[model samples]
Target: MTAITQLSPRLLWQFFDTLCSIPHPSGHEAAVRQWITDWAQERGLVTIQDTIGNLIIRKAPTPGMEQRTGVILQAHMDMVPQANADVDHDFTKDPIQPYIEDGWVRARGTTLGADNGIGLAACLAVLADDKVQHGPLEVLLTVDEESGMTGAFGLAPGMLQGKILLNTDSEQDGDVYMGCAGGVDANITLPYQAESVPSDHQALRLNISGLRGGHSGININEGRASANKLLAELLNEINKLQAGIRLSEVSGGTLRNAIAREASALLTLPKSANPALAELITARQQQYQQEFNGVDDFIDLELVSADLPQRVMTSDLQQKLTQALLACPHGMMAASRDIADVVESSSNLGVINTETEHIYVQCLIRSLNDTGRDRVANATAAVFNLAGADCEFDGAYPGWQPDPQSAIMQLVLNTHKELFDLVPNVKVIHAGLECGLFKAIYPEWDMVSFGPTIQGAHSPDERVHIEAVSRFWQLLVRVLRQIPEDKAASFK
Candidate 1:
């Protein structure tokens, strides 16, 4: 039996175990979505599916709580799909084998999916609970939240009957979230022609890996290195030689929301320059290790001989692409003035791919301030434009403005104080959340976010604290019972 099956609130852990059996990675949530619907129907709960596959399971309040206001419990149904290079797990077929360790729950060589899975499972547990004294309840399980907010973006108007939204997607147990940053996706494509490699040159593949990549927006302030940027930096250093070389392929980073942990490039180098190139790569890796100091210092670089390629990028195209990537911005650009040590604006060079005719790069830009996001996006586009690449900024989402005076916020704060004997910190997150988009559809809804303690999200190191999960459940139960009678009646 899994260790989680022995945890408290047996129903919650049971549902979480069910989640582990299904592979619901971002954009491929059909199987999980159908399972959730069938499970809800089996229990006689009213289930509704939105156009984009978002599920809403409505549960009538416990008899005495009917007069209270309706509340919405929201969470994403998707998880980031990532695994160690050496792990042979297929996200579409392999189940996440999570285990207990040192009071934490982690998966073997892959993400544990605790980022939002715990939240979603909590909703299911609540529905199954006969003891929960909650009002008319709606569990909003959305899809594609890891890669984008498509489900939230397509939420139907007037579909939700609740006015108080409890977003359970937050990652900290003792802290509550009142607001979150907005984000945009930028894609740049540069056309290039490939030429046949010189007969005398040798093909070499350069790789950089072993980075501790976390959520781009959440960890952008951490001075962590980006594999994409590191690869480009190496290429730029080599470009200075002005020697004849041809790039066959260059790529790294998987998702736009994830900080790139690995990158590699296939190129043709002069047979005589292999010795110097190897030495330069070694030195560069050392410099990067020192640059990061102790954090993420396990940076690794590998240079290996490869088979000859038929085509390589033309010299002019290679030069321009290298210059553009070097000039591109990656990581935090501004700090929050209102919140100390909090990031206000940042960008992640999350993906890079070299194709037959073009090199494509993807960036996710996040900002609490819309103007700041626009400024950074414009700067990013300018860099590619000057380098003759076609760039576009799309999929923009707005930020959630904090409302400290809201009734739900006060209720949450008071509930935490009662449970923990201390006031919980209320903060705005730099990461993208679906709250802002939900507000667009239902402006009348008041929202607050909180969840169990999850660390190293969006990476294979992701884990959830076991103790925190119990506390989070207790807090949620208390919050459901304590929504003031006057406030509940006011929503109508």
Candidate 2:
């Protein structure tokens, strides 16, 4: 057992500790899936894997509760792979080193994977514990939720027999989420011509780091900076002042759903302009610090020597790309009129990458309505389109429309009041949850998302509250026991 197993609710922590030892980044969950399957089989529980790698593990109801409404506990198996710029960690093969600190579980300079991992572990704990009473239970573990939500999108009908779904992906501990924003990915491809480097040019790498890049959805309205957007703004400023600089490469961000924290660009400039470039970079760094202020206080901009490349983007292409990036829409676009202080629509300039043939730019557009989502997506594409780039949109998922009258939501509310002697906060979130897609397959299923308190999700600063996990587990167990029996006895 790891040191974290010593925490309260040891089973959940033990499972989570084991999960950290296995690499299960988005689209790379085969090892964890197999581990879960083997663990279930050893316990004699029934397990099934769907076509797209979603796992469904079933456990019979506790005695005398067999006739209750079947309930599904859902969480994703894959986690967002993020590490600090200075952390030497390979998410594909290396284990995440988790340690307890200040009453929370945090990974060392990498994402802790507790966003849904804790929920997944909670399900495992319930399955392994024979003392808890519950109705017919099924645990649905989806894959690739971070990258594209492949498992949720590809889930077919009739896979689950549950009438109520409890999503274990929400980050807030004292709240329940009934609705979430729908999303679509905007991919822009800008093909550019490469030209030989200008004579007597010096190559220098420009880096922007130490900015707090958070989950594009939950943290979109937080006024955080996107590294891709910042880098483009800096490069655009340089273009306005110095015409002698040629861009060789520019890239920032990793996943399309994460606000970029770091960005770097390689460019060649006339040797005589080196001193002027340094001065410009310093000025821009200070300007950004002042702009971000308390939100992103430690934004660092650095310029360093880089190996010279034989070719660079043509001056015209560089200018066009930088201009398009500057015009690209990011951050919160509109606020919800129905729910005060709720984000209704937003766009995140999530990622930018350079290739041999073209530069790929990805943006995630989210809104409460499909029309709004498409509007932002089209607007984002139009900016790149005007720059002579081709734009394509895909991976569209619908929003979970709010259902305040849902029985499950009421039960959760009542359960929280009984457990903590306080009413829980109920609201709709701007983040995308798989509950919306699950509705398409199981239209009659009532769904609600709740989880332990997690901070800094989708970033290296991610951490989960220790006490909240224990309380969340208690609530989950009690809710299962209190699931009203179905008069029809829906389970087969």
Candidate 3:
């Protein structure tokens, strides 16, 4: 093991550092799966690998605690792979270079994967520690949770034997997540024919970069800028110049859960208006800098001359595409009246691309309530249809409804107070979690989620709080030790 793997928390950091060294991007997690299986076998823990590659490791209770109830500890093994555009790191084979920065462990120029990696590390640490007291334990490590919930959805009906489950995927340390928002992906496509460019026109590429983007779910309501929206805004200004510009191509965003930070467009304009267009772009760039001065200080817009044989999109198609994008909603649609600070409904225009056959756009819609989710999705589809585009929605996952009377909630509250002087805050999150899928599979199971402090998840700014990991470890151990035998029997 390397020095980084041999750091404090011994087994925990070792597993984490090893995980960071391996490349486990969403659909490609074969290497990580084999490593986990080897680790479990070496530890003598009873393990089973599902067809979808989800691993379930079981450890029988200590001699005297054999009669205690079985508890399921759950976390996803995959992460949202993201990095700065200028960084040359590849998620398929590069190791994340994590280091301490301002009290947080962050990667050099890529996402730290602390969102679920820390949760998985905590479970490994607990299983390796023989000194920690606990009942029969089952650790569930899921795959491809960042891109989709495919592993969770493929879990068999009777795969797990535990009646109580503890999810370790929450981002905040003290927040107990009992419920989460349900989400659906709406994919829209608009076909348009391309035409040859006129020899008299000049080609220019317009670029938008350096915006501070974050997780679409967590930052949707924050009013942070989106590159797709910024591009549309710039086009709207360019149209004012009336330079006979013809849009050739447009593309932006990579993941559904990440906010778009950069976008580029190729266009052709009459040579007579070259000087006037350049002046307009410069002035608009400065205007935007002053407009979002404090919030997005690094935001920039650039235009450069380029040459192309053929025009990507015809003038008619470009007009329709730009109008549709600008008409589409791209931010919080509604706020939770029930919860003062929670966002109830929101939509994110995650991805956009222009191709020879069609123009495609992907949007993610989220809502705390089922009816509200449908409403938002319907509204979104209406926008696309109005713009003469065919839209389809898929990958809809249910939300975990908050249960105030849950037995797990009581245990967590009591255990937290006993471990520390203060009680932990219990609430629901606007983001989606695997707990929602698990609840649909086993409605009788009681579930609660909590984790260490992780910042800038789903973005290159991702980080993990160094101190919170130890505290989180301590809290998990305390909770396991306090599960009374009588209470455990009641569930069975």
Candidate 4:
């Protein structure tokens, strides 16, 4: 048993510790799935697994509680895999080293997986707890929520038995999420030819690191710098300045859902212009630092020597690629006109790859409405298309629409008020969630998402507050016990 399991909130943390000991990054959920399956079997509960690894663990209502409405406790089983560049632990082979620090539970150097892990553990605890009361219970544990909503996408008709879903994948403690943004991924490829390096040219590598990379959806409004965008700006400025620089290689960002934290590039320029190029990059770095002030206080830009290549990108291709990337939007394309301070439409230049054949750029566009998402996607495609690149969009998912009068929503609100003695903040999110995909199939399902307070999700600094976990557990317990009776008959 890990030290975390022995903490104050022992039951939930115990399951969380077991989860951290297994390998379950995105699509790799086999081990954890087997363990949980055996756990349910050992308890003599009925368990069903779908074709795509979505698990349903069902327990009959506790004595005299069967008439209460059936509740589906939902959470994803997979986690986003991320680590500090310096961390040596392999996510696939090693258990996350979680420890308590200043009242928070954090992993040593990798993502703590608390975003949905805590919620999953909470479900496990509730299943094991005889003291907590509930109606006919169904736990719908989906898979691959981070890489894509694959499990939710594959959820077949007639598989789920509940009309009410309580998604525990949300991050905020007091906030109840009713709706979320729909999103799609756009790929832009620009074919290019290499040209011989000019005489008297020096090759230099420019690297930008130390950005507080975060979830593309949750952190879109934070104004944190996108490394891909910043590097593109630098390259575009160098081209405009006519510093005799030629692009050799460019790369940044890893996943389409993560905001880029670091970017680096190779360029060849006239030997004498090296000093001027460095000075310009330094000035731009200072400008960015000032612009980001408190958010990205330690943004670092470095210029160093790199091995010379026989050929570099042709000047025309270099300019075209740089300009297109610069023209492409990176953040806050639009805000909600309906809800105050809630983001409606947004985009993330999530990844860029400069290879021998072409430079590939992938972007994720999100919005509360399909029309808004299409509008921004079309505009982005236009930018790359006008620059002579082929643009395509796919992997689209629907958004959850808010129903303020939903029974599940009102029940959660009342339960939260009773537990915390304060009005719960209910709002919509600008990110994608499995709830959206699941809602499309089960249109009659009433859904609400809430969880413990998790900070820095999808990044190495991820952590869950100790106190908030207990409170969140309390709210879920109370809400499950208070489910109305009429909905129970409807869950055939």
Sorting all predicted structures by lDDT, with the top scorer first, yields: 2, 1, 4, 3
Q: Residue-wise lDDT of candidate 1 within 237-332, one digit each (tens)?
A: 888766665788899999999999999999898877877787888898888888887888789999988998888988888888888888898899
Per-prediction backbone clash count: 0, 0, 0, 0
lDDT (0-100) at residue 275 of candidate 3? 84
User: Cα-based RMSD of the predictions, in order?
Assistant: 1.7, 2.1, 2.1, 2.2
Candidate 1, pairs of clashing residues: none
TM-score of each: 0.98, 0.98, 0.95, 0.96
Residue 315 of model 4 has an lDDT of 81
lDDT leader: 2
Q: Write the per-residue lDDT of candidate 3 for residues 1-492, one digit (tens) a residue.
A: 444464456677777887889888788788888888888899999899999889999987766886566789998888888889899988998988887766678888999888899888878888888987888899999988877788888887798888778999988878788888889989999986778787778889998888777788888887778888889877766766777887888888888878888888988888887888788778878887888788778888888888863865766666777777887878888888887688888888888887768888998888998888889889888888877789999989888888887887788877777777778988888888888899989887889999889878888988888778767877888878766565433321
Task: Point out where model 3 deviates above 4 Å.
Answer: 1-8, 486-492
Alpha-carbon local distance difference test for all models: 0.89, 0.92, 0.83, 0.89
Candidate 2 vs candidate 3, lDDT winner? 2
Clashes of 2: 0
What is the TM-score (0 to 1) of candidate 3? 0.95
Candidate 1 has a TM-score of 0.98
